[model samples]
Target: MLHVIVVLAGLCTMGMAMPLPDFYSYSPEAGGGTGVMYSTAHEGHITGIRIWEYASAYIGGIQLRYDGNWTDLVCVNSGTPMEMLLVEDEFIVQVSGKHDSGYIFELMFVTNHGRSFKVGQPSGTSFHLFPTHDGSELRFLSGRHNGWGITSIAAHWAVYSSDNSVTP
Candidate 1:
């Protein structure tokens, strides 16, 4: 009985030593049409973002940079491209956008350093996304996209260590 109690106590302490990552609920997906679903793999801290937006239409494409590696573009690249690179210790904390029934119209990514990246024309319902817990940040993204543009979008959030690794 004493041995069992000691083992249980050790397990509890071990769990407390390592903080778990928190996953905030995804934002409401905007737009219409069926398309292939995609989810960005969480590797390291998101250091940059590139967005392709039609001049007066919808968002055309998007890409994320983890550490120094860039993810594949999620949609066709036929629009004006805008990019934002983060400095060290900076992270995306919020994502706000506008979308109609057909496509995502606009997007804005806000960083912890008070910097922001805004793109596309504003003409549709608006959505603002952020993590629920303090210290958590934008970790990844998932949604569907048609051949020409992003039809729907969502954001993922989690707490990461200083080295950009997920907290154990």
Candidate 2:
């Protein structure tokens, strides 16, 4: 009985020491290249994310993969990013800009499945979602402003297996 109790306590300690997901960053290649910002094809779920301000520019779109299909989650350039959220498999955001301020936008796992996924202020130009190349691409529009451009993207996700994985 004493030996079993000691072993059980040791197991509990080991489990408690497991580390959470690590942070990752994706930047443009030196000479412009193709890569996906992040990928978990058959791996795991992206629980949360943070977008840093690289430069002032319009946030075009986000290319996300669910199940096995990919979809472009886009938004309007109506405003700057006030806050961001990733619910389930959807990327939702709130923006306030010169044209349309205090608006909301979202991209679902499925394309055009419901509500057109358009909200907030309407404008002639809306953000376009970019695609991921080889699970190392982070897409964005080109321009310089003051409070636009995504400098860095940090994501929190899990790995299905330890065999196939990359960390930075």
Estimate the Cα RMSD of every predicted model relative to the unseen true structure.
5.3, 13.8
TM-score of 2: 0.23
Task: List, residue by residue over 44-72, the lDDT tens digit for candidate 1.
Answer: 77899999988788998999999899999
Off by over 4 Å in 1: 1-25
Model 1 Cα shift for residue 166 (angstroms): 2.7
- Give the Cα error of residue 81 in candidate 1, in Å: 1.0
lDDT values, one for every candidate: 0.82, 0.29
Off by over 4 Å in 2: 1-84, 87-119, 132-164
Residues 59-139 of candidate 2: C-alpha lDDT, one tens digit per residue: 333334443443333222344333333454332121122122211122212121121233222432233332322232221
Give the C-alpha miss distance for residue 104 in model 1, angstroms.
0.3
Q: Which ten residues in a row have the lowest lDDT in candidate 1?
A: 17-26
The TM-score values for the models, in the order shown, are 0.83, 0.23
